[model samples]
Target: MLDWDDLRIFLAVARAESLSRAGRALKLDAATVGRRIARLEEEMSAKLFVKSPQGYALSEAGDRLLPHAEAAEQAFAGAQEELSGAAGQLTGQLRIGAPDGCANYLLPQVCARISDANPGLEVQIVALPRVFNLSKREADMAITVSRPTAGRLTVQKLTDYHLHLAAHREYLANSAPLTCKADLRGHRMIGYIPDMIFDKELDYFAETEAQVVGLASNSASVQTRMVQSGAGVGIVHDFAIPFAPGVVRVLADEVSLKRAFWLIRHADDRRSERLTRFAEALGQGLRDEVTRLERLAADTTLAGL
Candidate 1:
């Protein structure tokens, strides 16, 4: 008989694209993951993955098994949560996929509170630079900068947040004055790599005339760190600015940008009232947090730092 644990391992390997990454996620060593995958393949008497220099790619057999495996995973998760409920406790895992910016700067506080409230619940944060596919069950919920146009998902505006052109105090003092948008050309700029920009909302340089980015990364947290290190001026979220010493908003009057976060979840999961309540609480907490962030952003004392 096939083992469910092996299927879980297969899912991890498929999602991660590499044995090393799958091992990290599963808390197993690479050799162990490899052995389990080999064992699974032997049991099925078929090739499940195409091992390549690039990484493991799912074979035809693996592709055929994926959806069913995902369904079984979902069913198992639902059963565990429901069974726990019979014992008067809610027990399940909630994976939230978010961009590095939000995941690093904001979700920590929110997730902490959720974990405190539900001691039996396990929370997994999938902080990735790319878009999350809700249809694939990549996340139980997702927080996206823009509302997705199409998906069988429940979407709501979490909150409207702000971003500003910012740089370290030392970088601004030494660089050419950014009295206007035109002055931006004289200084180095850091932002997301143009070709790797996964969403249109993250293209901070779209309206700017920056000839080239001095530093670029797919992760917004990396871009923020580079800017904080006095590398260059970059657009940063208001929530993140106060936490980084010596970082402050620049050209605030001229370059503030408004964006909203959309909360998304698979529509079918709405049947669980616990998740719906948790989502509601999380959304409200996010709104309150953004309000605090906006106040801090507008404060000149902190901005001077």
Candidate 2:
């Protein structure tokens, strides 16, 4: 009925038979021990100890629970050992969640390496959307561009990414080039729904006619493919633009915006090797890969935007 911590405190009190002695043994104060024991007793609905002039003595309920207490102690100890082995050996599934773009372009190789390294460990990469649950354990680790604020969640800034309005090179052949951010208003735009919103920054292109709700699907990959196919000028990240025959950069007049990417894990769940190794390996590898790709994207801009 009680938590492991409460059970540990209760066992200490029952073994010592003195609140003060149990508190001393557990490195907690007598009041703390009393409260924990009270909570346990309330949960089990059994008076565990009776107060005497000397100190605490086991009640009938407490006396009867001694064997079960010892068994629980041994069982918990065994569980701890098994968890340690699981973490160290990583003989389980590693679930990594991220947005579609990162999950598609980056995580595949990283997951392959993780699976190859830990043959016993299986890796499932889930591309969670803008609003997903990490606290509910939807996935073990996340590759995100937005900052998250969840209890027991730990985040690390993995890398920086830049977005630009781009289009097919052929599409831009006869049209006027977008010299400034506002020039995008005149272009036939292929837009993408905002994935990781830069809500805090005054990103120039966030909510203009450039990103007019009048346009296409919400998929980033769709935005990329459409732009590549000369469907319309779209806002695509530098890293996702494929070096196809036709793509070109549209509005190069002003710097759009660069966002910080994050690799996050639940602090409580980091004890597992599946999460630990995957986060570390995937984060560092993706950062390195993105850095290299960003440099390449700078060299060959997207077609139109």
**Which is the leading candidate under TM-score?**
1
lDDT of 2 by residue, 35-79 (tens): 888888899999988988977777999878755665565466446
Q: What are the lDDT scores of the predictions, listed in order?
A: 0.83, 0.68
Tens digit of lDDT per residue, candidate 1, span 175-278? 87777778889889999888998889998887676677988999889988998899998988999887788888877777778999998987766666657766
Task: Report the Cα lDDT for residue 6, model 2.
Answer: 79
Pairs clashing within candidate 2: 166-304, 166-305, 167-303, 167-304, 168-304, 247-303, 248-302, 248-303, 249-302
lDDT of 2: 0.68
| Candidate closest to the true structure, highest lDDT | 1
RMSD of each: 4.7, 12.7
